[model samples]
Target: MKTDVTPATVRDWFSEQPAGKLFTMPTISAIFGVAPGDERRRLAEAVRCGYLCGFLERTETASGRAYRVSGKGMRRPTLEEGDRARRKAEARLARDDRKRRARGAPVSPNKSSRVRAARVSLRAANMPVPATAVQHSVCETVEQFLARGGRVQRLTAHWEQMEQAA
Candidate 1:
């Protein structure tokens, strides 16, 4: 902490806030010449409870409280800007799609496709591949499955597999 942050100093900072700008907790504390060290938490509590500071309210989509100095910060984008952003985003996505096609990588469409993609990444990294599928004893007794079945094991076999991998 630089110096003792009094309520009067905080009130002055709030009064100096710009009209249309918003600030977070750390930002406000930094404005007060406070270093973000051991004393930062103290500053946060002070700002949250500084009843004199105005417009220190929590935004709906925001995690912590945001200090809005303007009339409810609308953030409405211009029509031309919105259209430009959409076009740029779509063009970039299309370029990425072309590159994927050039590389011959399959598109992940479902859960099984996601599994296949994961296996491909692992193989690329030179990791061991896992079993594709394993059968389990669904209706047979443990003794029957152990003696009669070929290689079907219990579901707890995953733990054994994990230990062996480790």
Candidate 2:
């Protein structure tokens, strides 16, 4: 738990907790070795990313909320790690955009999914890429799309196309 403190590890830890164990914010934070405030955010992120369940274990507290692990096994990356990965990807995207601009090529803020798929395509095609290239993230692209007032109605093929476009 001390070393592999990733989302996956945390989910495992949550499962190892007693079946009906309820955690106060500070107690949970203590388990994670982070501040209660930070743990609150991390817990929310973990739940949002599907690593944990939506419902609280105890909802009748007057001071604050209490939580327990669902142990449902829907784990994903932790938000802090995701943020770091996102910043790294955006940096790479900005660098690529700069290069495109320097070459007098068309450059706009990129759609993250397309960029990711394009990178995958490049790898599959065995094309030579600049050594400085970095991986792109779908979340970054979606953020730009949202900033431009784009909306997703449903997750049909058309919506998927639009998501890639975004």
Candidate 3:
């Protein structure tokens, strides 16, 4: 039987291995509940915790995330510009949507310009197309980040920092 190698799949794999021994965010995301591409923040947190570095390499992909165990302080390559832009736009949409929901406001009908732009690019590529598909694409993008060891400090802390930075 072909086993499902999803976030849950990767999480199960890592959980089965051992705790506290440099598991990449992708593995954690696959098993855990985080979206892909969002793993960058998780990786940052792991880096803060001294758990990950160049050694624990992970990479984001169009479909999902992937990872492998590695030594301490291992620095893998960074995301390309296009990929980074895609991630940022998706994250912004997710954050804004969450905020809108929390405020008990009606959800916005149209996606942010960033998301629209991304959709346009995706469409131009002649990829299987869908108009309202940005949200799912964002989810997949977050999964990619997760695979690449993304991290998010608790959402509350993140919001506070954003407020202050703003």
Candidate 4:
């Protein structure tokens, strides 16, 4: 009898396997009656979900990448649990986005113009101008630093003090 191949079924199979018994992708595909080509793609997604949901543990072996059942019991994660995980991940990402924006460059109409002028002046002085992406990154960093009431001072004296101590 042909068994239905699904993420839950795959998870169950992994859970049934003895702990630490490694099974590679091809071995799994064959055991689950998963065909090559398009069917393999679906199986791969199922395996990925199993890994993500903590139903399986992946590791590298001498043969290749392999997976085994997680020591965490056979209890399947519910739909609500999956949704909660998704929400938590989204909230973390949003928090990170806010932090990045808080530390990012101030939005100003003349910001690009100022960056362009700086690059032009550097080139005119025969100094190697940084690439456009790097120039923007440096400009943002400097703007953020200055906006925070920070000042740039030559660190030569500090370095000389450290050198004398050494």
Candidate 5:
């Protein structure tokens, strides 16, 4: 029971155990002779790896969440399967990034760089510059008014009467 337990080890161990036997984190930790603290992180990682590799199944029981041997097969994942999984994950991430970009979400990690890029794009497109302080203050005032349940109405013909009164 070395501190470094690989997913393969977990899978092999579960394969030897009786099928349909549920195991909780504490029970697994105890079996592995590891404390349910910082030392248990490696065990947790191994458990997660076993789960992702389809050798372990997670289920919700009356006691709590538990893990059991999948019993599907005791075979290890092939290198090609791992490569396909990695490629799928990468493609998913790339697709999500594209979707976020299409929704006008910031792609740059740096806040200042995002702002700079936005400003540059705006200038390139001949769009209006960012709002001034006065414009921002007016927007804040309108937001506050709306928050306070105030209603804004269209003046329509009443504009002439207001001008005459002024």
Candidate 6:
């Protein structure tokens, strides 16, 4: 079986597989090309995590066991779940990319301008930015200040207090 799972492959398997039950490993592996070892386990985990479901009778085969998606609670995924999942995944990827960039690793160019600015500010200082700026990300503010040739300066307690009074 192949190691990669594609939409076309999954579609083909679902068509041949009885509706309403979950698919078994060998059947899935045959369609998607999952390896017999860790790959198979990983694919199974995807099913267990509710990404896939089974409903057909469990059957033993020479390779391993498998099940069908039982139609009882089966329904197509809703747009809300799909959208929310996509958003969450995108957020997670963005966060990971930020962490990577912070560590001097390469990242994609599609990152938002605000996110980029915040990254710059965070790298330059350890201070906690105000919540309003944090929600927008600190990157833009840092970039704006830097673009104006302004530099961050540490303030002594007295100076900070005096500035606040003024």
Count: clashes, candidate 3: 35
Cα error, candidate 2, residue 154 (Å): 90
Query: After superposition, which runs of candidate 4 have C-alpha atoms over 4 Å from their true positions?
Result: 73-76, 80-166
TM-scores of the candidates are: 0.32, 0.37, 0.25, 0.44, 0.45, 0.31
State the weakest 10-residue window (summed lDDT) of model 3.
1-10
The RMSD of every model to the true structure, in order and in angstroms, is 22.7, 30.5, 36.4, 24.3, 18.1, 21.1
lDDT of 2 by residue, 1-166 (tens): 2333345555566667788677766565667776446555765565334423433244436657766766454434335878989998999999998898899987684588578878999898997656986787656577687899999666569878998899
Ranking by TM-score: 5, 4, 2, 1, 6, 3
Model 1, residue 153: what's the lDDT?
A: 48
For candidate 1, give the lDDT of residue 105: 81
TM-score of 1: 0.32
Clashing residue pairs found in predicted model 2: none
By lDDT, the better pick of 2 and 4 is 4
Ten-residue stretch with the least lDDT total in model 6: 48-57
Residue-wise C-alpha lDDT for candidate 5, range 6-119, written one tens digit per residue: 566777778889989999987888887887676688788888877876778999888777999987763565457689799989899889878888999966355777788899
Backbone clashes, candidate 4? 0
Sequence-dependent TM-score of model 5: 0.45
Give lDDT per model, in order: 0.63, 0.63, 0.55, 0.79, 0.79, 0.62
Candidate 1: list runs displaced more than 4 Å. 1-3, 51-55, 60-64, 69-166
**lDDT string, candidate 1, 11-129, tens digits:** 45665777656677767777667777756766766555453334344444365667654333223422476896999898998888778878998543668778888999888889666
What residue runs in model 6 are displaced by over 4 Å at the alpha carbon? 1-12, 18-23, 35-46, 49-65, 73-76, 79-86, 89-166
- Of candidate 4, the 10-residue stretch with the lowest lDDT total is 133-142
lDDT of 4 at 36: 83
lDDT of 3 at 142: 71
